[model samples]
Target: MKMRLEVLLVVTAVMCAAGKPLSKAAARNKLLLISFDGFRWDYDQDVDTPNLDQLAVDGVKAKYITPPMLTMTSPSHFTTITGRWVEDHEVVHNMMFNTSTNLKLPHKLTLTKSQWWDNGVLPLWITAQNQGLKTASFYFPGGAANYSGQVVNRVMVEPFNHPNANETEWRQNIDMVMRWFSEEDFHLVTLYYGEPDNVGHTKGPDHPDRKTIIQQIDRTIGYLRKAIDQHNLADSLNVIISSDHGMTTIKKRPLVDEIILNKYLNLLKLASFEILDYGGFGILTPQPGKEQEVFDALSNAPNLTVYKKNEIPESFHLAKSERLPPIVVVGDLGFNLNSRFIVYVNKGDHGFHNGEMDMKTIFRAFGPDFRRNFLSEPFDSIHIYPLMCKLLQIEPAPHNGSLTVTEEMLQLHSGGSQRAPVSVALPLLMLLTFSAL
Candidate 1:
């Protein structure tokens, strides 16, 4: 009787261990989130992109993806990942400044420091990890930093000094990402390449060199596809290709004294401010009791619009945070806040506004989860975060986008199927069996 009871207990323990429900991690779908900085929606139309064109043919293509208000790099990128706008995510500008400490958090630090990135909201990587999935990042902004006291399983910060190294690194990056995918623990991945945006700044969007840069990236896409096929992950992998925001041509530079704040507001009285004579926009922080004074001075400034912090339109998502400057000034189309001594005559510029065609970027989805060869109506980029969460079979953090908005772009398998598929369950069960043994 004692021997029989012992055998039964062992059997019961095995059965219980094997019967464990499909966890979020075991059921998670694999995703590769790729960001090609400043790759505009119409860029392919301008340049021949065979790889990108093939991706469009194979999966859903959004004609143009609207970026968040301000349409800047750090803001829009964080918006896509967090499903929150610039104001909500707290990466208001590429360079975030803390008024209280008089500390400026530049782009480089924003990549590695928790103080710069962890603003109460967890990004998708952290959220995925909570559900048991592992994440890796390759040069994606915000991926290098600690989010809510945790970092991804793997992180590689692309060096800024070696800008030219990107071309060579593209092939290497694809190999590394494929390696992560082969790891059972790595369920989500992100890769970033800053090009055409870089070229656009120097050579303008229409320049031959900018088009060449796009072509170069397209070839990298082809290499990625070939590598994935070789690794037999073509069917299992889901790839999302996107860009932060588009670039627009800039020529006009306002004289330094031409700026209302520079012209009238006492510079010594202000806490901290940004006003470059060459760029189309700037922000200002009044010391105290000077909000109205700064606002009044910038009132009716030609070719520029100024707004008090509270007065900025809610749709822009610019006014709610204390991190925002007290006075925000935006330049009209083709105009920048240039000064008399130094002029900004960059060939291309962004941060104008989301409505501008040049500020509109690309969104193309390719993989098992998306519908094939479909062209979607232009949609907001924020919806992407929800789509990503839905694909990974994980819960998304509280985000502003509605899943219904992006539902049409996905296939049946990608939607509402939180249960682990038989394909995944079998492997998980085997692993559990080994663990029990």
Candidate 2:
């Protein structure tokens, strides 16, 4: 009896070892999450985008997804991947500012500061790595930071002053991501491009130059899909093309029309620190005893809405963080909240209230798992995190998204079956092993 039991145990071990390879093969499809920074939802509408049109025909396209409030780059991008509101993730702005020291870091320098990004929430890259899947982030916002001392399997931070309009460099990035998926076995990779956003800021969103950049981006999409085919990832890899937020033409003419804060309140006397002149958003810490006075002054400012931090509306999701100031100010659409009148160069800007139509962004998904030719109704950008988690077959950390919101975008296989459950497969495999022995 001992000899027979030993032989049966050996057979079971062999069967289990053989079955693992098959189980892993069937586990989940690889994901490529690409963010074209500042690519507006309707950008392709005016440009000749054969590739983008093809992508929409081949997979699912959202009407236009609403990004989280305070539609700045760092805040919006973090929300896209982590599925948390800007206040919830604590990456409340592109520039990291400390109210105590009045210290501020520019967007580039802030990219490397782990403390600015690692605050408790786990981004998709780190979460995937912890679950034994290889992941990478190539120039994606919040990609370079270490989350709780854990980093992505591979990371490439965009160098300072990196040219966003270099077409060749964009192709090279696509090739590298292909290698990450095909050669290095990366299960998920987040790639970013600083294109149309840069152009939109320099030239107005309606300018012909911005349209040209959109054309360039469309061509890059063609190159990306071709590279996927060349690398033999066409069948297995899932691709999501998306952006952080849309751009709007900045209202620069008629200086009187600008929302100048100094014109309304005495900043020096009433505020100890302030983050003003940042698009449509402003936050300030009141002087020790000037809280009510400061609030009343800005409350009556024209074209600007003032809110006490706790009194901020629930819809904006801008409250409930220590990083937030006691007083919050927002300008009307296309209006810049200026501290003083200066030569405002950028013809375009974002960081407005998300409810503005100009603040909505794009989302596209294509792969073996996604349904074909589906035009999905607009959904919140936060819902994307759960969709990605479901695609990777991984348990998502406590996120604010619900899979039910995005599950319909996926394809249901024959007999309504999608992936085979491991529990069912393992038992059947064990029975086969026992029968063979």
By lDDT, who's the top model here?
2
Question: What tens digits encode model 1's per-residue C-alpha lDDT throughout 199-277?
Answer: 8878888888888898898899899899888777877788999999898776543433333345545556643555444
Write out the backbone clash pairs for model 2: none
Estimate, for each residue in 170-197, the C-alpha lDDT of model 2 and write its tens digit.
Answer: 9998998999889988999999998789
Worst 10 residues of 2 by lDDT: 413-422
10 residues in a row with least lDDT, candidate 1: 252-261
Best by TM-score: 2
How far residue 186's Cα lies from its native spot in candidate 1, in Å, is 1.3
